[model samples]
Target: MAKSMSLLWGAGSPPCRRVMIVLEEKKLQGCKHKLLSFEKGEHKSQEVLDINPRGQFRRGVPSFKHGDLVVNESYAACFYLESQFKSQGNKLVPDSPAEQALMYQRMFEGLTLYEKLKAVIGYTWFVPEEERHDSALKRNKEALATELRLWEVLLVTFFPTVATLFRFGLSAERYPQLGGYNALLKDRPSIKASWPPHWLENLKGQDNLKDI
Candidate 1:
């Protein structure tokens, strides 16, 4: 079954890397996969669109396929893999009900985190320079600061690898704990094995949230 699975993903995309990390953690490295290029718009190619019709309109890497089943959403792909291959690798879903509930809550909250972070910095990447405004950027930074306050507890969570992408903009002086946690996550075997090829080639990344 692992041999029959195939994943289409972009190396630099955090969501795509999240799926890769899950696959590694689940001992599904035998699954065939291809790395698409966002710079070249390979994610919108006909091959991807065939499995993920929404790819035509949305940015859609991290698409997973198992036999006849296709999973388009990154979070769904990770959960499906965890559920289907529960006994194959390291346990992900907690055995206790309370722990499971907390894990699920954190898992879903990841979407809100991504949304808030994107609002603060996505414009510089996706929006045209002419369309970007200082006023909107200010509002986004304020909203993100508020969101960060709510997540001030210890950093153990479902998507640590995905969250590490934000480290580029996060100041170590301002977020010392998160900086240490980010370093630890990057050293994890799954994260290191699935590290983006492009990122390795270019060690530096854009600092879009230096002000935040």
Candidate 2:
């Protein structure tokens, strides 16, 4: 079953890592994958564009293909995997409706958190130097801080799958609960196995949020 799956992903991307974690948890290790380079704009290459047209707008990668089914969104692809292969390895989705609803909410909220995070750290990289402003960067950091606080409060309710925040300079000292949660998650077999390959090469990550 895994043989029919193909993934186009960037190792440094959290979204791509999420799908990779799910795949590992589900024992779908045989799925073919193309590791793209974001630095080289490989995510926007013709190979990715063939599967996800949005690649033209920098909205690609982490694309999953299962037989004829193609899912471009990271979270949706994860849901599809959990729903279709519930009997395989680990059970990700809950049996009760209430728990499932909470999971869905957290999943979507995670997307929002990722966007806010990118807004802060990616501002200088994504925006043109001529158009960049200190005020805009300050606003982005404030938004990300607010989002992080929300997640910190709910940290105990779910596993810490969004460790990207820490990599980008979210101080574990400020959010002790989240820091502990992330530490526990780091030891999980799936998470450890799916950790970004590039990150393994560089133990120290970027500190874009040192002041946040």
Candidate 3:
């Protein structure tokens, strides 16, 4: 653990949760840590401002105000933690040459996942009820549907062993695979420890209906 490292984060945001998850997964031999509260307005404080030049971020990833490295994006934080704690989970990240290529591909998909989810959250919950845009909602939902199909097709085409289990294209399809994947993701102790439990409401679980 670095002597001067600190993680500024919120309790329920997925982005912050991801950071915490990565750290816990790495579990470097000795890491002293602190969790700053976003609800307390710590993120907007001068301390954070000094470290994050942009002074702004998406999701719950906090800006680092005074560190050798500052990160405001959750995915970047994941990449950073993986690099810093390579020893603990020497093989946590994909290592084989083919896996390496797949890793980048997954990261790219993960980035897209983050962006699309953010849009869903912003449209469904963040925007004030009165200011909410139907067009935006429609667009996001449509996009989500499209993305769902893409994921389903890939699952069926490339991972057929797990294909029967996931219903990706529609809520009415059999999605045991996707559900299994989500269950696996949630099973990770690191993700379980850091993931925002309170925000589960935001998930609405509507996507699960695809298998209906």
Candidate 4:
């Protein structure tokens, strides 16, 4: 039997885009999908909320498949898809215990940690502008930068190849860490497959964050 996926999603949300990228990388073509649009404020409809596990009383969980495995979360979905195929193609996360540990560390830093920082700065002040406090925004900004520095450190520690580092502009003199990490991740065909969907490119110049 063929497996299918429902990509519960909205416009320009990085997490949703990340999941789409992983699906493409896995080449899990047999799955079906439900493309939920944000323009219509569909994520908030009770139907979407009920399926999401994140207490996401607001949005539904997007899922993907390859045969029998139904997966969720951009990170877990990628890991499961790759693990199921056991393909010799580019590996997204290394199989080695030591390297896998490092990969998880960096991946989580980018995924989970970043979400917290964004939440502190944006979600915490999610109220209308009339209620937003400059003091809180300032505090959030400081916290966000501090959390980002953690990623800078992880990049250099993980990626060692110079050729791979060029994409993120991490010259040897500046951000050596991130440059190196980019090099490490750059060669993986699987990771490349996970690049944000073409639709995400629509976010190129929109400075203000929109509800997705």
Model 3, C-alpha of 168: deviation from truth (Å): 17
Q: Where is model 4 poorest over a 10-residue stretch in terms of lDDT?
A: 159-168
Residues 44-140 of candidate 3 have per-residue lDDT tens digits of 6676667665545333345422247677776687777787668775445776899888777865775565455456545655677888887887777
lDDT tens readout by residue for model 2, 1-212:
99999999887677788888899989999999888888899989888898998995347888899999999888889889998999999999888999989988887887788788779877977999999999999999999888778878888423434577778777889978878888878889988877788788998888988678
**Model 3 ranges off by over 4 Å:** 29-40, 57-60, 64-67, 124-132, 153-175, 197-212
Number of the predicted model whose lDDT against the real structure is largest? 2
- Positional deviation of 51 in candidate 3, in angstroms? 1.6
* Decoy 2 TM-score against native: 0.93
Tell me how far the alpha carbon of residue 99 in candidate 2 is from the true structure, in angstroms, after superposition. Answer: 1.2
The residue ranges of model 4 lying beyond 4 angstroms of the native Cα positions read 1-3, 53-58, 61-70, 128-131, 156-204, 208-212
Candidate lDDT scores, in order, read: 0.77, 0.83, 0.54, 0.50
Order of candidates by TM-score, top first? 2, 1, 3, 4
| TM-score, predicted candidate 1 vs. hidden true structure | 0.91
Best of the two (1, 2) by lDDT: 2
| Model 2: lowest-lDDT 10 consecutive positions | 156-165
List where candidate 1 sits over 4 angstroms from the true fold: 56-58, 125-131, 158-167
Give the lDDT of residue 51 in candidate 2. 91
TM-score of each: 0.91, 0.93, 0.70, 0.63
